[model samples]
Target: MASSQPNMERFLREWRQDALNKAQYESAIFIGDKLLAMTNDDNDAFFLAQVHFAAGNYTRAQALLAKQDLLTSNPSCRYLAAHCLIKQNNFVEALAILGEHTPTHLFATNAKRKTTRGVRAATARANSKTSSRHHDQGDDIPEEDILNRRYEASMCYLRGLCYAKQNAFDRAKEAYKDALRIDVQCFEAFSQLVKNSLMSPDEEDEFMQSLAFNSIRAPGDDPDMEDEPADYVQMLYQTQLSKYHNPQAFNTAIESLSTHYGLENNADILLAKADLLYTQCRFKDALAITESILMDDKYNFAVYPIHLACLYELRKTNVLFLIAHELADTHPDEPCTWLAVGVYYFTTGKIADARRYFSKASMMDANFGPAWIGFAHTFAAEGEHDQAVTAYSTAARLFTGTHLPQVFLGMQNHAMNNMTAAEEFLKTAYSLCKTDPLLLNEMGIVLYHQDRLKEAVKMFASALKIAAETDSDPHAWLGARTNLGHALRRLRKYDEALEEFDQVLRDGGKDAQIFCAKGLIYLDKERPEEAVQVLHEALAIHPQDPIATELLNKALEESAEAGDIGLLGTADAAFGGETSEEGGMSGDLASFEQRLGEKKFAARMKLARGRRTAAEMPGQSGGVKDKGKGVARSGRRGAVGGTRLFRGDQEGVDSMELSD
Candidate 1:
């Protein structure tokens, strides 16, 4: 019998590895069970339990581990048992098995190594003491740790999972932090903290610094540490966090991972690269990366949402509709599919349908944040500010990790003219993310409204600079340039402000607001003749724009008073020929006459000579259209340029018109 034992055990062990590798778990479990039944050896039982665990037979695996004396005498067995419970989603039972506390000292770090005899002896003594007190600190161990030194971090991580599942986010955040403290290489903990936005930017920075990376290192890393000033591993960890000012470092980190680890094509690395591009506001490039990833692995759901967002941001209505249709047909079960559908409806102007689909997407997966944000966005688009705020507020609470919800909240509040509330939410979001150009633009808008001209200019300039450096999407960052011009105009920097506004026109080609902005600069410069010309261009594009029309009247009055008839040539031939040095991107006065109707058009022309400029005002303040631009767009908050409702009501453009 003893002679047969060696051959039988060896055969079973070899067969176990092959079967497990093939995921032929049923056959492996059957064969392993037979061997265990015949021998009843502790080693056989342990080997069988692992097979059961791998097969997701958690109850049976736990039972097998418990049946052997190994459960009581071995830390590995106890950890395995706890893991089985966790796999079964019996988090409470899992926590009970894991215990409530980790020791003061960190342990089981750099487990990719053999343990020295001294380490084993010390662990044995500690185990003995732990056994005597009926206290087991080891829990849910990964098989990689040969001596299970990482059990302390593992315990905290598992507890965090339990707390998060139970909606105890505050406790979960702490538990996750503790896991990182215990093991600086504990990526699970770090990912949880970052993915959930559990820590504010400062808190994350402080936490990263506080990690004990140098406390324990593998032998191979000793030489590298001695030669290098910075910890290579720490730099790698930093790469996994939010991207920022140091583009070179970010590039180097990715290169190291790609070259040293040969993970260039790895899904995680690719996803990280795509995410960085998206954050940089380079949606098209990000979309391309995501597309390449999906081409290789169509089921890579991780990249789907970003792809949809890029499409939406680019206003690829046709592509979005086609993709939405396909996803609805082929990937109906995915929440992202419905989100795509919702976005399609949104872009196509079916607000009600968009709302329904967004709700459906959210209901499909409560944790899918974009759906919640989309649902809130539907309300915001329709001017349902209160409902939008409430929905965004809920999303903010539910997703404590993302700054998007807070951004939307601030925007909604700003739109409603709740300046204080807007500032508070924006500040909080700023603490979380300092580099998002859209967020910075929003901050600048609020400051502009608060009459903090200097601060607002600084914010706008920062936003424009960052956006310009990271992305070449002129349409995307045009708002920042326009807002900067607004601020510069307020600061009486006419030339600088005019240059900014001119740049917006040159880059984006034509924006009525940009023309109106230039008109404001001209007005500020007291060059009312030039202002009248630009304001004519603005009115040509948006005939009834309160700001454009009122500014035109103001310009005309000033021009008539100053007798600057360059733009107002001879009344008989005024606006008859092509406007030279008179109109800009709004085309010539002929097309303007065609669009604005000859009656109102003639009135404005007559008014340029200072004859009843106010009587023929283009549009009233209440008639201002929300073209999704404007600074004071919230009903009657007063248009951009002043409180004298452009009457033709002064067009109030809310500077906070963030496209994102």
Candidate 2:
């Protein structure tokens, strides 16, 4: 009968494990109970508790596993019990279970303790070893000690989660650090620190480099792990963190994942690759990968948010609107569904509606960073700086892993003329990730405003380089080149500035701002004829472009001063100004320019201060704010109140679904 009992226990243990793997918690619980009833062993009771924990029966799990004898003997028991308490929102009790001094085990009661079978041998062997490692271990540990350390690390991870939930981020960062240092495989704890941007870029890199990943040997990563490289798990963990920085390293890690581990076709790896592309601003290429993924597995929610973002970036409005409706009808509860709806409203210039839908998406999942960004853009579009800052601040706090929130915050502060604050925020973001295209461009603008012309020039050059590398559309990054030109012009490098301007124009630059900038450089170089030519072209493209008209008038005055004649009719005709029956400009050049300047002063003031009129609000994007040929797109995170589409009414969004 005893012999039969051993076989029965073995069968039940295997059965319990199978149930756990399959998430058949009822089966796990039933098998766990049978094993406990059969042996009345502490390990069996712990197994039962684990089953209960897996099934969300926290109270039962805690009561069974938190026995003083078991908890005192096994770190796993203490961690599991504390984890159960944490789940029940009993943080105090959970912390008590974890202990104040980082104790590996906790004793709830000092009553006569009966050690579990085999624990005595395990504990003794654990005590005798001198640990060896890739780096200094300080002391040796036996096999049992290694398991205890992993469980103890889990204890720190739970503490971090508890602290984070309470908004005690500083304390949470330390706890997460401890968890990661103790067990590099504690990915959740590391992810929390990374995703929350809890650490500075330097801190993250320093800590990551310091970890003893090479020396650490998980139980599963022993010599028996013949299928993988000895350092495969550690390499994979490294790939998982620090995703916001170091593209070269990321590519190498991905290559290793594909070739070394033969995970080329792995879904998770593909998703990582796609996310990397997105971070590099290769949205179109990223979208292609995500689209292929969804075609094979349609319910891939992980790919959905990024897919929506790519569509928005590419200004695929009709496609986005159709997807929004399809997602709303089919996956109504999904955060991505509402985010798609929000993006659609955003692209169409319905700022208020976009904000509402974004809020709904956030309500569905508060961790949805894109929703928060969209919500903030709604405010930014309407020129609501304070509210936008508040929204962006929340996103910055929530999604520390991405530099995007800080980028927007910096730009918004720049818009408000808080150059000091803008620089601080932009620099902070730069430290975290120095390579984002838009981020560099915006930072360059801030530097330009601060009169740090050389710094701004470098920033713009770097931005152009990065954008040019990944940008499929030659016209995509003309703004960066424009900014470069402006910086060069400020530095009186007229020839270099003009070259940049010429490149922008060659790429089909249509923004009047670019033309005005190009014209200004010519004026700076004392070439009034060239200035007049460019400004006239700018006004021809945008008949009522105030900046172009203002610049053109100055250029015309200079040209007339240079002994030019009969230029009035040609200039007026080209610029589409009011002309007399004789087809001549009205009044003298001085009086005409004076009156024109006074008439457009309010608009120029708005332009000079970088403020948008109600009609030029951000979300009013045509084709998701393609900048309307002559209009410069707002540098805000998403389109602010751009109420009009870039295209005419003929390009109306349709309800037709996308072709599979």
What C-alpha lDDT do the candidate models reach, one value each?
A: 0.62, 0.62
RMSD of candidate 1 to the truth, in angstroms, is 12.5
Model 1, residue 567: C-alpha shift (Å): 17
Report the Cα lDDT for candidate 1.
Answer: 0.62
> Which candidate leads in TM-score?
2
- Candidate 2 scores a C-alpha RMSD against the true structure in Å of 11.4
lDDT of residue 6 for candidate 2 = 82
Q: Among all windows of ten consecutive residues in candidate 2, which has the lowest summed lDDT?
A: 632-641
For model 2, the stretches where C-alpha displacement exceeds 4 angstroms are 1-4, 11-24, 67-69, 103-141, 216-230, 242-244, 329-333, 399-402, 451-455, 465-474, 523-526, 549-601, 604-660
Assess the local accuracy of residue 513 in candidate 2 as a C-alpha lDDT between 0 and 100. 62
Please give, for residues 273-382, the per-residue lDDT of candidate 2 as tens digits.
66655554566786788788888888776566666666766778898888889998899989778877887877677778888998998788665556777777777777
Sequence-dependent TM-score of model 1: 0.75
